[model samples]
Target: MPCTGQREREMTAVVELEAGGAKLGLMPDVGGSIAFWRCGEMDLLRPVSDPHLIAQHGRAVAGYPLVPFSNRVAGDHFRFEGVDYHLAPSFGGENCAIHGNGWQRRWGLDRLANSSATLTLDHAPTRDLMGQWPFSYRAQLRYDLRENGLSIGILLENTDTRDQPVGMGFHPYFPRHAGLKLGFAASSVWTNGPDHLPALRVPVEGEWSFAHMRDAGQEPIDNCYAGWSGSAFLRWPREGYALTVEGSPELRHLVLFTPPGQPYIGLEPVSNMTDGFNRPIIADSGVRVLAPGQKMEGHIRMTVTRC
Candidate 1:
């Protein structure tokens, strides 16, 4: 990650990495986000067109790491270790906290290289902030750009003295165009209730089935698919390119969110299903509890190929 570009935001440094005609732009200060990823003139990840917008909208960035937990935690609350923790609503309109605090705070640059970079965030339990999580933890994210594609690794360590519930994932936005096809292996899908919590777990069939490569269609999908095979494929017919996404086995759940009429699709490789903390222990809900000083880590790789 030979660094370039001036500070874009308040103390927010923008770094660019290049390898084998592939380029990646990173904003370490902006929740360790990837501003854009491109190979030649084609975009492998959806690029943020306006730099000014990223400061106010971190989710609109090309990609960002999800730490501590993934997705909503019901009414911004969860019980762990016989104690209840309440998190303030992280998003604008949503009543529950979405994603984790990592995306909403700045991360420190740990290391930088020509083709890779590492960012770290250390969260200590404080009177004001700890009320939301009630635990101390350290999160590390590394982005490596290879000749074929990009690989992202996330590590979460429970720095507190007590046990803590943990989940992790990656939210990467990909360009969605007409004639695009998606394929993945998942045994079931999680239906959301009115509050966007997991209402039910249903088998993957009919419109929710993506066993074979097929167009995403017009139906809106904002659900988590359980029993994921840890791999997925997205093909762009109009661009004559395809992207293969593979994740570590720890990432047993896949959350697919294709907002109607949106130009991009979010295929997230997550460690747990929605509201995993509150749900019963199931084979597909990839939730885990880390003891004091314990750490959990996972990786996701994206390879691009010409169709």
Candidate 2:
């Protein structure tokens, strides 16, 4: 079933996956985002039981796929292959295109099982969707349930006739506790400007540092760290367990969105940074241009265990 409209999110049916002490719920009609994830009664991602809530606010869902690109496109326009394309200000509150159209459109079930499923999204450029992304591509998300964990595999193919810049990742929302500590390694970070887009590239230091296990959600952060070690973990000292997030090497950037006062933290495994396509040094910005018919695949896995 297709998404009715922006406001009228008519839900089709939710796909449920269960195995190895894990339960996952996915709403194919609602941007194919994860509704809830639980491992033995413990919420892995921020669990949402209300289908209406998932339909209304996809941004608050447990997790979602970021495809064709991740994060913002900046300035509502970008120059590609010597031609300039202007992204319509699809973001209602801002004059920029953010987070691509994947997380807002509908996805179909390609296959399913007790613990494994595949969701597919075929996007042919449209005048409306072109406001956020003006490329033709097919995105496939393969979700597998593991013992006390879950794994997501993404495969994106450039279905366009011309070269198209592509990026992809998963945005998993994790519950943050008072004693939660995040551990990750990165060489540098892209600091956000007033517009919440990366304005400066700086070394990982001060509040931007996560090289060692440090308290998370205490300070506000919404930056994309480059040169990621391809893995990160959140340890809840008070809870006695840790959730480790591991991404494929191709997913070179990790976006940490720990908003102050918010109960959830988003540790996104992305292939590019905010506005990477518009960066001056595009070569080093993590954006890859895919030739016609070319495809790229990556995966992210999250496992839980006692600390």
Candidate 3:
């Protein structure tokens, strides 16, 4: 079903997908983001309450996809194939390019069903837009709602004339409440420098460890974890529910962001580490170079269960 709402002067529309008691709300016109998701009466994602903020900042919504690359690119520039590529700072007042360009641009609805939808964005070379990336490409996002949870697929193809460096990921914001626990197995975590660029890779230990289910207390965090096991779990004892996150093996990295005092946390599955393009000499950096006409695809599934 289709739903429309207005926030300030900008109007936004949502496409609803339902299966059994699970419902997903998507806004293809707003950065192809997930407006809200619920299973029965329980919210699986943090719902955006401010309409004006939703109209102005799509990334601030529940969930948004990252394409071509994920996380921050230091100095807003990188070198590929002996050519230096520069990107305009997409995030306001930030000197680095964050989360690629997908989450800020509108995606065209390619197909829609009662419980599923497909959206596409063609990044054709343009003077103002496509220059952010050195190559032209097409990105497709498919959202399928199941009886228990939601499944998202991301497909990116290199339509440029030469090879291109690529990476991708998903940013899902879940409700962070008391008695909430996060569990995931990761081998190492990156320590961020003053500018938020990864400065060192250290073993996961102490407060940075998530090897078992434990309450994510008020410790501030905004760092990337490497060597993820492709599986994660979230438990909310107070809400009597839990969610299991599973992603493809290509998503070898995860970024956790727990803003101080915010009622939400970001558990992201990404294909590369932060500033991966700048560290091309590192063999396990997770950056992929795709030749012309090549394509890369990955999927992430979130299943909810009542405790």
Candidate 4:
């Protein structure tokens, strides 16, 4: 198990793995950031004022970016297989529910190695009751630390006898300074209204693009993209570190979110998409249809390199 940081008040645990002159800090709560992985700086991730920022610092489970459904689940209800599943509005909105109830839940930590650890989170059958969608599901998150890199694997197991439509994704905020460059490949992008719902699918035009490093700062993009090439890259040329995120072929979609004043950029790799219920993006990404007792898995791997 990684040792808890010397400062107990932080109340966060760190698992450090050293290789190639780089250390990986694995925080049990703050998701995965280089601070925990590389021992860079503490204040970089430990937010002092914003409770929500502190809440998201390094914890691994509780669903990183969003949950059972990322962004807004669209009234916590969706029609799947001709049946309507109404999920309670855990996110507290009129008809739109924001994020899912994954990050708020606790996850159990299993194996703890210097460079790796496995965390498991459960969604009881009752969790689905409030929303009208009922099913037993377990999500396991594994972080394998290696030299200058980390691999995050997610496994969603449907223990229910009836087939249910499921969605999951990672919402990691990459540290973005002036010297950072982000790159990814996508064929089409979705246009959205103020509510963050998909308004339409449009071809990648001039500036609202990720095909290359094309001024991601000037655009306001809270949208989903299909026909992704399956990989995304972020490079800090001045810092000499680059992080790579890739998903299985099944994860064919990506959500890029740029909030106006935030220092970090969110590159979300998801199995399904925002408002997938009405949009039904599962089929486009090869969303798995689990048998009575089956499991679906995907991974996001990152390698940090110092040039």
List lDDT for all candidates, in order.
Answer: 0.85, 0.82, 0.87, 0.63
Better of 1 and 3 by TM-score: 3
RMSD of each: 3.7, 3.4, 3.2, 4.9
Ranking by TM-score: 3, 1, 2, 4
Off by over 4 Å in 1: 1-12, 48-60
Q: Write the per-residue lDDT of candidate 4 for residues 20-126, one digit (tens) a residue.
A: 54565554444332234452431112121223332343333322634455566765677777878776654433565555555555467777776677877666667
Q: Tell me the TM-score of model 4.
A: 0.80
Write model 1 residue lDDT over 146-257, tens digit each, in one string: 8679999999999999888889999888888888899999999989988878888889998899998899766788999999999999999889889999999899899998
Model 2 ranges with Cα > 4 A deviation = 1-12, 47-60, 280-282
Q: Which candidate number has the best lDDT? A: 3
Error of 1 at 118 (Å): 0.8
Better of 2 and 4 by TM-score: 2
lDDT for predicted candidate 1 compared with the true structure: 0.85
Candidate 3: stretches off by over 4 Å: 1-11, 48-60
Models 1 onward score TM values of 0.93, 0.91, 0.93, 0.80
Residue 191 shift from truth in candidate 2, angstroms: 1.4
Residue-pair clashes per candidate = 2, 0, 0, 20
Candidate 3 lDDT score relative to the true structure: 0.87
Best by TM-score: 3
